[model samples]
Target chain A: MQSDLKRIVSKLHSGMRIAVPVDYAGVSMALTRPMIEAGLRDLDLVCVPTGGLQVDMLVGAGCVRSVETSAVSLGEAGGAPRFNAAVKEGSIKVIDATCPAVHAGLIAAQKGSPFLPLRGLIGTDVLANRPDWKVIDNPLSDQKDPVVLIPAIHPDVAIFHAPMADRHGNVWIGRRRELAPMAYAARETYVTVDRIVEGNLLADEMTGAGVLPALYVSAVAEAPKGAWPYGLWGEYPADVDELKRYAAAARTQEGFDAYMSETAQQGEPA
Target chain B: MSNVLPREILITTIARLLEGVRHVAVGASSPMPAAGAMLRRALDENERTVRLSILGSVEHNFFTNGSCELFDSAGQGRIDAFFLGGGQIDGQANVNLVGVGDYPQVKVRWPGSFGSAYLYFVVPKVILFREEHTPRVMVEKVDFVSAPGVSDPEVYRPGGPVALLTGKGLFSFDKTRPGFTLESTHEGESLASIREATGFAFEHADSVPETPAPDAATLELLRTRVLDELEETYPAFAADWRRDLAALSVPA
Candidate 1:
């Protein structure tokens, strides 16, 4: 397990790409607002899986790089799960992160084992002969096996919201158990948890087998409503309507600064 | 049909166009698009059906069966009609959310556009849906074109967008023309209003048509069939959203 997350504050850098599940918009918003407000060099880029709630925030804050997605999601970019223009303008890059299953399938393909046995995107164009995809012969196998090879994600950092985490960086996703493969795709992982259990829990006890082990995670922060501006399952979440209002107000820089000043002090109500 | 227009009229207009549909698929993070597809089922158009799927997110609805394990909805291949969003859309409807730069050091970093660059190329009969229409949101040449639109549709390797929808009304590109052209406007909203809100040139060959209002039967069917199932499927979220809707309906 890793040490306390306060260490991360010191470790912040200028060119790191933090890949995260955008649903935990709170953790990201809390961590980012200060950077945007201060105009700091840190907190460089945010990569969201398609359909995340706070795509605009990442865009408005102006700290996003390219996003990875399947070819099927390009047309409808302005509805629910909308990917706004700021990010779409070259900041959004495409890869096949359509689902964690696709990621794992790519990893399996990279390893050159067998059929990239995956469940989702079974019928979608994620399997199309696009520039983002490559069919490579299995280097790991003696047989000349051609597998659908997806490039490794290698996120500079991956952060997620979880129900519980240990002081030792054992992150646990309680009921919401998606994105584990993404957590795996990232190079470093950080978890913001509601509770910090004293001892380590078994992998099987928690969801997705605690995809982030202490070995992989750099730090773990205790952040509630970290999924704010987004949402958390039973707990409080970012009022989506409120976010829409912010979207309206965020159109201009002056308006954005005013909004930030007003909302910065007011964290999600406890 | 009653004077009260229902969301069904619009949904059905799109649904009928889905007549030749065979294999329908959707991506993650697309609830409304998935719901629209489900609404097709609500219309009892079972034989010609589209599937639904979605990408999972942190703040999104997640009662997952397993990690990286698709929801029962997506596992059933029940995802179709992607609901994505963007800002500063271009004439060709090319989308961009990511900052313009190489991988590491981008100049003006923004939130990354998650799926559009990929999804736009594949989803059959894509509906470029948007709830907001403003000057910057709708634009001339998108400064950063992440997902290629009409200009490069033929170059794209997959099926492309069919219709573009907005709260103001509808937009489409000429099979023969270059970029996007105006098709219609919503009832009560004017061409001037739409033009003022757009970021690009308002291109229209002729006077735009008024959007057809929703019907009573469609609303009733939605409440009975679609809303009811959604309420049962997502009680907590439905309760919260219903309360919010009530608050919104309250007189200022």
Candidate 2:
């Protein structure tokens, strides 16, 4: 299991763009821990639509060089302290985006298209700041109509956590279908699962609908409670108290370091 | 009538604004809006079915396809109403959820724009809700435009702001005029007070009406059915609201 995790991390290089799913869907804290421990640097992070704790921790740990995201928050806990501070200090680049734009970009990549046309953002700072995004007249409309075009966001690696995976490496993501596009748009996809079931997940028609085929999964590791602190859909609820502590401690760099060190000590072996 | 809390009034007002809507979608971290949508659902249960989709709720959310489906649904004109809050909102209804100061290096950073940019243009009745009514929040112009209130004539925008509700009052937006008009003030607020609190210019009637308080039955429904449903998604907020109501009812 440890070897598999190491092998997955080996493929990751500094300055690589990696994509992760949003918070409500299972986020891979297990995978994130190893990358932070390895002192990975200068990576471009893409939040499929939005992000929360995982993005903040990576920014705090100095592993991210740029964050292309719609939003990064702690939900009920409040604003993401480290991420906000980093952006204020100009330590990292922020490609500010709206939720649909992020999804549109990934969808474009999944379809091998150059860009996808989206409505809204006609006269906004989000569009003004993004030089890569283009506003063009709708060719199909005879009347003057304009739309924004979002370029494809092809990440080098896509990572997330799930309830379970079978021996054939088919991962069951349930209704978290956003992961499918992330997996399809990336060159490689890594997943950490709570457990590996005995039977082939794709063989059963009932479970087959929710399964991501092994063709897109580059590697899978068995790590129980892989999405700790953050909740898995039906597994557990988020640790709000712990998130609050992180939110408070992460307000200062010294406090953040202390929190990180303490967290590192308490981390269980993979 | 005297026992009504300010939040209950806001919830009732929300329900009023949401009347006749087929489907209303509330986003993350908005307990008030969720409560409002639930009240609307409860009110329309016998007469008509008003579908409510509160994001981040397992039971209330109807989307099985994940987060992207919300934006997709709104774009297709399936969602009739939505709620948006901002760190800074101007008279023009421009919202700034990104932060204050310049781009990249901001003095104060709030969360980045979530689904606002797309939903504002797609959701027909986008209600601007902000509990904090002050000069700092009600700015003349936002530091950044996370979502513009109105777009160019050539832009493919099917929706825009219909109203702005705050702790102090409710203001209706006229897209043709591209500005806000003070509709009604809350119990303690007046036209002069609202003008003093607001940073931007807005039209107001000579004698503005006070926002109507929730009636006895409406209050009863809010205290019971609405809070019960809201507790599933916002346990702490529900508990706090109940506690506050309990404290209010005590002899003082």
State the displacement of the C-alpha of residue A61, model 1, in Å, after optimal TM-score superposition: 9.5
User: Candidate 1: misplaced stretches above 4 Å?
Assistant: A1-5, A13-17, A25-43, A50-156, A174-187, A198-200, A203-211, A240-269, B6-8, B20-35, B45-80, B83-112, B130-144, B150-156, B165-219, B227-252
Q: Taking the tens digit of each residue's C-alpha lDDT, what string does model 1 give over B116-220?
A: 544554454566766678766687765555555642221323345666677776777543455667777876677888888777664775678876654667556
Question: What is candidate 2's CA lDDT for residue B64?
Answer: 78
Please give, as one word, the docking class of candidate 1. incorrect
Model 1, residue A81: what's the lDDT?
23
Fnat scores for every prediction: 0.15, 0.84
lDDT by residue (A71-146, candidate 1, tens digit) is 2121222232223444334444434344443445434433544335322121232344245456565577676544
Residue-wise lDDT of candidate 2 within A1-270, one digit each (tens)?
767777778878889999998887999988887888778999999997888899999999999999999999999889999999999999999999999999999999999999999999978899999999999989999998888999999999999999999998999999888889999999999999989999999989989999999999999998788788888998888788888999999999889889988888886523
Docking class of 2: high
Model 1 accuracy (lDDT, Cα): 0.51
Candidate 2 clash total? 0
Task: For candidate 2, list the clashing residue pairs, or say none.
Answer: none
Off by over 4 Å in 2: none
Identify the leading candidate in terms of DockQ. 2
Interface RMSD of 1: 9.6
- Deviation in Å, model 1, residue A114 alpha carbon: 20
